[model samples]
Target: MAATLDWKLVVDTHDAPALADFWAAALGYEVEDNSALIDRLMTAGQLPEAAVAEHNGTRIFRGFAAVRHPDDPYDEETGIGRGRRILFQDVPEPKTAKNRLHLDVHAGPDAREATVARLESLGATRVEEVNKGPAGHWWVMRDPEGNEFCVA
Candidate 1:
């Protein structure tokens, strides 16, 4: 038998919470609410106030924030998701090149344009439109942090 391991995709960003918020809205995911865990850690003196920040009326790790599928199970004590999720971590440097990996959002051909427009309204920018005639159509887009993704 094979063992199953849990995992999440992490993205480097200048602002972790903001990026998390953007992704959550974009994917209809929920931002993990770790305030209770944060408070407990603070009371235990295991985490410093300097290592936390207030975002969207909640306290989150200073350089880390995450979003997960709304229907997924999570650890209530830690606010860690147990299913599909994405973590945004703050980094000192800006993105200087194309992403080695990217996300492809499937909205079907009929909804592609509207989906791209909605993503744009949520701070994503269109990089280019790719059309292969009868083959397919997609829009290469960039998130607020310049990470690339495709809407098809």
Candidate 2:
């Protein structure tokens, strides 16, 4: 109908690279690199070399990068991307409230609670724990930026 929605999630953060790194490790996603494209741009004098920066052996736009589930589509050569991803973009302002949109991660069995604890160990904090209607239970937590996410 609507061209079959291409993606299912978007997570925003003030520190895109650090946020991307956190999510990448937390969600088992691989950090993406666009070094080749940057390289091409720099070589053609279309972009300054300073615009490209390297991190963890991957080249990307300076001050910005992203990560995605490893099995998801990602181009090795150009770093143009596809599949599940979280693009970290640079932004100003410390997050000051619950996010209007938040991620609800699935943790198996008593795992939801355990996941909450784990996320807390990783700098996330519990905001609330509550049961949704039948067959649903979740714990709200804030990311490092105070943006909220849920584990259920």
Local distance difference test, each candidate: 0.93, 0.74
- The C-alpha TM-scores of every prediction are 0.94, 0.81
Which candidate achieves the best lDDT against the true structure?
1
| lDDT of model 2 at position 138 | 89
Candidate 1 on 11-92: residue-level lDDT in tens? Answer: 9999999999899988899999999999999999999999999997899999999999887789999999988889999999
Worst 10 residues of 2 by lDDT: 1-10
Off by over 4 Å in 2: 1-5, 8-10, 132-135
Name the 10 consecutive residues with the lowest summed lDDT in model 1. Answer: 1-10
For model 1 the TM-score comes to 0.94
Best by TM-score: 1
lDDT of 2: 0.74
